[model samples]
Structure formats: structure tokens, C-alpha cells
Target chain A: MNHPWTGPRLARVALLLAVAVFGPAAGPRSGFETMSPELRAMQQDDLANPGMLHVAEGEAQFQQQGCTACHSAEAMQGVAARYPAFDAARDGPIDLAGRIAQCREERQGRAPLPREGKEMLALSVFVAHQSRGLPLTPNPDPRMEFVRRQGEALFRERRGQLNLSCGQCHDDNAGRRLAGSLIPEGHANGYPLYRLEWQGLGSLQRRLRNCMVGVRSEPFAPGAAEYIALEAFLAERARGLVVETPAVRP
Target chain B: MARTLLRVPGTAQRGEVVEIRTLIQHPMETGFRPGADGTVQPRDIIRRFTCLYNNRPVFEADLHPAIAANPYLTFTFVARESGVLAFIWEGDNGFSQTETRALTVA
Candidate 1:
């Protein structure tokens, strides 16, 4: 019998078990599918979804910041689906928020917004909202391959006091109960989502940090390269999943 | 400044019941919570929400600390005549916001 206590061995076993049960290629499913009917209803109703408030705030910011001077709302459609794109200036992959921050600094000649601040969240939500209902389309630039691989490694690497990889719960035990909450497949299609736990809209990075903390691991600093890499990987992993920016999560 | 969202039917038949939904962004900090510095954060919450139809009060609610951040309220009012509907929220820290929407009734 294979020992299941070793980190890599356990992770491999978990993956094999997942593949055995789910088949070689399981269809991408959204976290929305796992939510209760009430939450699903909440997410569907624009009037009731609190995340729309951020979208409104973002709209105001977009106009006030002269974003309309270069990009109209129509021009922004499907932009979010192609995130974590290669940034030649940074010589690295940059997520949508990072790209926005860079634009504010380079093009708008303004200070970058704080990563987790309200202004940033509003802008991200607003930009992402443009891509709502579109599929996540990862950047096809060959340079992104390295970062995507790094993200996959991070997803499968076991760490923290619990010695758990993200795939262990999100991939292997998806749909299973954990502390009374169903484990989702950890797709990034609906990001800058409004989580009831946070009582506010937050970026995928915030959720990732929360998970890291859950496993007793030190989270990467906000806007870190690692987070961007992971985002790139998640984008590819969640390919074809429709964007649900500002989605409500219970 | 807090962002607010208001939804109302653009037109309705006279005597028809119409639903009005409003959502506003606010922390609604319950004074009982401690801040990062470990001191009790002073309470800040939207204490009241009032809706006026044609300059007359139609709905009013007294919000408390228990209300979640980003308060959302949905209520109904009878359509009578074409007029402006006003929403006003009052809260601690001298917070207040007023928004108006026009409803056409046939």
C-alpha cells in the first residue's frame, strides 16, 4: 500500500482519486452552482446584490479618473477575461488590477491605488463587470507559460500547518463539506466578488490570502508576483467559465 | 461618500403596486467591535431610511447596528400619479444622502 502521509505522495493520491472519480476531464463548474438557492437568487438579482454598489462606485471613478478619455465602457468588454497578461515593462505577468494600477501610475500620472482599498475594489469591479457573461480567455503569449506553470505548482504544493495544497480541497474534495460550507472548485471566473463573510467586495487575491491563512500559512504580500502567477494559472484553469464579476458568495 | 443604488419601475398603471429597492454602501460598524489597535471602534451606522412619494412619506425604517454593512431594503408602494420619489438616509457622523427618481404612472 502506498503511504498517504508523505506530502507529494498524498497530493498525488488525492489527484489520482479525483481523476478516478471525476474522469480525465471534468467540466468547469462555478462556485455559484454550489451556493444555496437564496444566495443564487441574491447573485442573480441586480437590485438586491450588494456587489452592484461597487460597480456603481467604479463607474463614477472611471469617469472621474478620465478613464473614459481613452476607454469607453463598450471598449472594456471582454478585457477582464484576458488577464494576467505579460507586461513587458515589468517583465512579468500582471493581473487586471495590476495592469489598472500601472495605467494609473504611467498613463494617468496618479499614485497607484491601494491593493485592497475601496477605490481599487471599485475600479476592479467596474472594469471586470464589462466582461460579465464572457468566457475566461487566458493570454496566449508564450511568455505567460512560465508564470502559469508557477501557479500550477503553487496550487499543488502542500504547505502550512495543515500541510494542504489548494487542489486537495478545491480539486479533490470539491462538493464536500468543510466546516459546514461546501468546497468549491476554486475557479477565478467570478472575482472581485462580494463575499458575505467579508461583508464587502474583494479581489481574488484577498480570497487567496484568506485561504492561505486558513491553512496556517503566511500569505503572500498584496500584489505579489506569486499572486499574479496564481491568477494566470487560475484563468487558464477556469477557461470557458463565464465571467461573473462582482458575484455574491455566501 | 457612500454609493447608493435605487430601482423603481419607469412606468406603471395607476393603482398598481410597485416594488422599490435600494442598496447603499456603508460599514455599519457596530460600536462593540474592536479595531486593529484593539480599541473599541466608535459606532457608525445609518440609523434611518425614509422614502417619500410625491413629497409625502411612503416608507420609513429605523436601522440599527445589527443591520449588515451595505444595507439593502425593498418595499412596495401604490402607483398613483407621475411624480418624483425621494430617498433619504440619515446616520451617525452626520452622514446623510438624498436621491430622487421619477416614476411615470398612467
Candidate 2:
């Protein structure tokens, strides 16, 4: 039988030891960099990435639904950057998905699609895709202080059978592996992304729900204000990072 | 609802090897897994995909249950003349979708 510590394994051990002793050679990288080359290529290719499909569909809906009569796609540029903003009408923080739902109801004079429905998700993806490369710049508002504080508490509070909070993995153990995948810093810069696990484009709330389920916690409903607050905190934390809308994650 | 997306070059030089890509929203269920109630879910998957240039076949694939949901494919073909590229997907439950794109060759 081959020796367990010989060759590449030994080299890997040596590399890990060096890293442990000397610390990492460089600053943190987006979880994007940790992906396979093929997945990276897919994220870079507009045509090959499946997430683009949803964005394209959203573009169609934007025009057909009469949004273009009021605003051009260019006008929506950088609009997503200010999402998870305070909405006085809702009396709470609202994410891009929530904002889109409100607009559909009030402006389009139509019943709003479910926040997580395909059409709404696609429309939000399409709108956010226009803001690609912009920074996560959620506008500051004094009214949102309470929500932001709540979000911080939730992020830090231990929950579920695992008794782990978002900070435990994303803040402390980031870059480490829990299962087969590396735990990212959990930035909200790239959202309405296509996750290979879901095999479809999903909102950040969907991802958050998945995280809750992973920890055996009861997930909040799709449109619950809790997710919006969490999103607000994440957006604030990820401020200045360029948006990677329609991001592909495995 | 099943939605399809195609990526074809809007403009290309004559005889260039243009890359065309396609993706479709599908579950591609394998019938192997149990549902929330512990009963086996039925199998449903897209089985065939075809791309036609100027009404002539250029690329095709026969997908299996093992394929992931939202099947994505990329293929290359010679840009001979300005024409239309038609993409077709056929699968279980009598599901089929066709989308077309225009190509300009100089």
C-alpha cells in the first residue's frame, strides 16, 4: 500500500503547516476564486451561465410590464446598490425583491407576484444585473438603526441544534471547510445568484433560508422583515464591494 | 414554467467559429429520491436538445436523468451566412420549447 504521507499529501501537509505558521500570503479572496476553473469560466461567460437566463427573462418582463414607460434599463443602473433601504410605507427595511413587489402592486396596477416566485425573482435579477460592477452602497438612514441592530444581534446569536450563528462560520471560520465546500465570508454583494445546489436562480433570502435549515432552525417566510434586516446588515457590511449580480455558486 | 435562453453572436466574420450556448429551466428529476413524505418521486427529465442553423442541424445532445437541473450546453459552428439559429428541447411530459435568434455574418 502507498504511504499516506508521501508525495502530494506530504506537500499539502507542508503547505498547510507553512500557512498555519506564517499566516496566509495574501488578503481574503471572494468565494468566487475558490471555485473550479470550469465554474469560474461559466460565471465569466454571459452566454454560458444559466443565471443569465433569468436576467434575460426579467428584461423582457420589465418592458412588457410597462416599467420601461417610466424608466429605462439604464435608469435602473446602480439602483440595486441602494437596496435593503428603509421604506416608510412598509415601516421597515425592504430588499430589492420587496421593492419590486411594491412597485408591481402600486405602479403596474397588478397583483404582486410572490416574493420568491419565478417572475419576481427574475425581474429582481434583471434589475440587479444592470447594477453589475457597482458597489454595495445601501443608503444610510437613521430610521434603519433599529433594524440594523436587530440584524447584528441575529447574526451573532446562536440558534438551532448546532448552536451556531452566521458569525461563527462566516466571520471566524471563513475559508475553512464544513462539508466539501469552503465557507465564504457571506457577503451580500452578489445575489439573485445561481447556485448549483438549487439548480436555479434564487434570491438571497432563499440562501439564508438554506443556511437556517442547515442549522436546524425554523426559517422565516420569504417576505418576513427579519430577512430584510439581515440583508440590510449584510449590505452594510459588504459596502464598497463591487456587485456581482447573477453570480454562479457551487 | 420552462424558460429557455440562447447565446449567439450578434455579429460574426464569415467562416468564423462562433460559439453558441443554450440553457433551459428544468428539474431533470431522476425518480430515485424520496419526497418529503418518504415516497419515491416520479422521473422527469429533458431527453433531447438540438440546434439548427439556417434550418440545418448543427449540434445536438441526448440528455439523461443524471444531468443537473437547468441543463446548459455550449457548442461551436461555422458562421457561413446571416441567418436564424433555432434551438429546440424535447423532454418528458410532452414538454418542448423552441427559441430562435438572428445571426449577422459579414
Candidate 3:
């Protein structure tokens, strides 16, 4: 594979695996067109009849739950294009789910959503589904400098009882699969997705929170700053990755 | 069938530069969905869509597989004149639908 970068774009897959691959210059084209050997071997068990039911449920939750009353699906047009956006107003970064929570409390005058709660997940999926295929646009506004810097650190810092950084897997072992799932070049393109493990729609923060739990890392509050920091980093990394929010992932 | 949902603020007035947003309901099949035998499903997607003003075309798109289910699109256009804003879509499975809404300009 041709790589214009300084080194291989992807490192070895596993702790002991010795396969090497390269290239971010041709990354996007290859990512969607050709499946990595690891991904090609994946089973097609989850692909089946249409599953619009979850989307419908999410739509209902979005309306009946009073989410649309504040966050304008219209005013917020192309909002998903810019995310992990540094909110100068809040003096921090706001992720997709975090924005939802902010509206729940600030505008709707309700309690903050539970990070892993059903309504929160459903709402996140519905909102994220609103924007798909739009190129990710990470805003590196100066006000977001602090949060973005923090996020980069979080990405590089080793954590979990495993003491592995996110970079180890996403940056280091992109295109490799762990267990059955391919190690996607970690990006924030697909925010809310129907994960096979969850068997339902969930947001990126939910996935991050799950990973934190798995690593035995002290979990942040649902809309914690640290998670937003990580979101900012991933959003920046995925600058060109299309926004496939509310995607179905197995 | 893709459901086209449109939203305009109450403040919208005639001759105003308005943001036109559309959300169409369709499976947006990536062709990855499986059949009983477990073979790669042929790609079936909403290949194209168009926006018309007073029977004249204003905007159109040729879509790809990566777009999500029930895809949403938005663009802004001037409304100096009022007419029926009609949306038509064509998909791989021979699916087609047209939606129209009235617009008033002063």
C-alpha cells in the first residue's frame, strides 16, 4: 500500500499480531470501498429485515418528550457538521449528547438526562439521524483551545485497568479487528448507532462511557468534560469522515 | 417510500431568504442487508432527488450508499416569488414519490 505519511497509517492489530498497513492519503476511499481482510471475513448474521422501528421510537421520543421545542431541527441545520464544538459560551466543548442534555436542563427546565438512559439514547439517535453523509467539520475556535487540548491528552493518555490509550487501538491499530468488529479508524462520524452489543441505538458518549467502564476507568458524569474532550479530539481526527449519525453498527 | 418533512419558522415572510430543509423517509439500504441465504445484497439506494419551484427545477442530488436511512437535506434560496415547492425522488428499487407544499410571497 502507498503511504505519503511519515510511517504506516495503521499499526499491528493485536498485542501479538504482526500485520502492517499504511496510508491516510487514500484512507477515505479505501475505508468505504474495500473492506480490510479482517472486515471481509466478518459474518453477515446481523443484516436482516429493515429496522425502522427504533428510528420511529426515537422520533416519537424526540417529539413527545419536548426535545424539538428547543433544539430547532431547522435552526440547527448542518449542526452535526460542526461538533465536539468548543462552546465558548459554556467555556467547554459540547458533544452531540451533551447538547441534548443542555437543552433538557437549560431550555426545557428538566433534570439532566441519564447518560445511559433509554430516552437519552433514543433522543440522541433521533437527533443524530437528522444529519447523515455531511462531512465532519470540527470547529477549532480559540475558545475551544483548552477543551481540545484536554481531549488530545485524553486520547493519548493510558487509562483503564488495561493502561491503554485510545490511540493504541484507533490510531495505532486502525483497520484491525478485535474479536469480530473491525477497529474502525476512530472518528466521530457515527455518533449514535445501533450497536450489536447494546442491541439498540446509543450515542458516541454512551460508547465512550461503556469503554471507560470496561477499562475500569472512573466513569465521568453523563455529560462530563473529559468525555467531551475525547469527543472533540475524535471529531477533529475525523475531519473528512462523513457524518453517519444514528447508524446501524454490528 | 421516503417521507419528506419540511419546517419553516413562523417568522418566515414573502421575499425572504429562507432555509429550505427536507427529510425523506427511506431505508437507504447500504446493500449490506442480508437475504435468507446470506449473500451480499445488491445495492439499492435513493439515487437522485429534485426540488422544483412552480414546475421549474431548483435543486437536485445524486446520492450514494453512505447516506443514512430517511436521509435529510437542507439548502437556502430566495423567495421573491411564491409557488408550489415540489419534491420528487427516484430510488434503485423503482421507487418514486412527489411531495408539494404551497408558498406565499408578497
Q: What is the lDDT of residue A29 in candidate 3?
A: 28
Listed models, DockQ each: 0.72, 0.55, 0.03
Interface RMSD of 1: 1.0
TM-score on alpha carbons, each prediction: 0.90, 0.83, 0.56
Lowest lDDT 10-mer window, candidate 2 chain A?
A: A1-10
Model 3 over residues A1-250: C-alpha lDDT tens digits?
1111113224212211322244543443213223444322221111221123445566888788786765565555457668767655687678767777777888788887786676777676666656655567777587766777788999899997988888898778877788876776666665666554554456777788777786788777867778888887777776765555554455
The candidate, 2 or 3, that scores higher on TM-score is 2
What clash count goes with each model?
0, 0, 2
lDDT per residue for candidate 3 within B7-61, as digits (tens), equals: 5433446668877767665667788768789987888788998989888887889
Locate the minimum summed-lDDT window of 10 residues in model 1 chain A: A1-10
- DockQ, structure candidate 3: 0.03
How high is the CA lDDT of each candidate model? 0.88, 0.82, 0.65
- iRMSD per prediction, in order: 1.0, 1.7, 9.0
Q: How many clashes (backbone atoms < 3 Å, residues ≥3 apart in a chain or on different chains) does model 3 have?
A: 2
Query: Which docking category, incorrect, acceptable, medium or high, applies to candidate 1?
Result: medium
Q: Which candidate is the best by DockQ?
A: 1
* Model 3 TM: 0.56
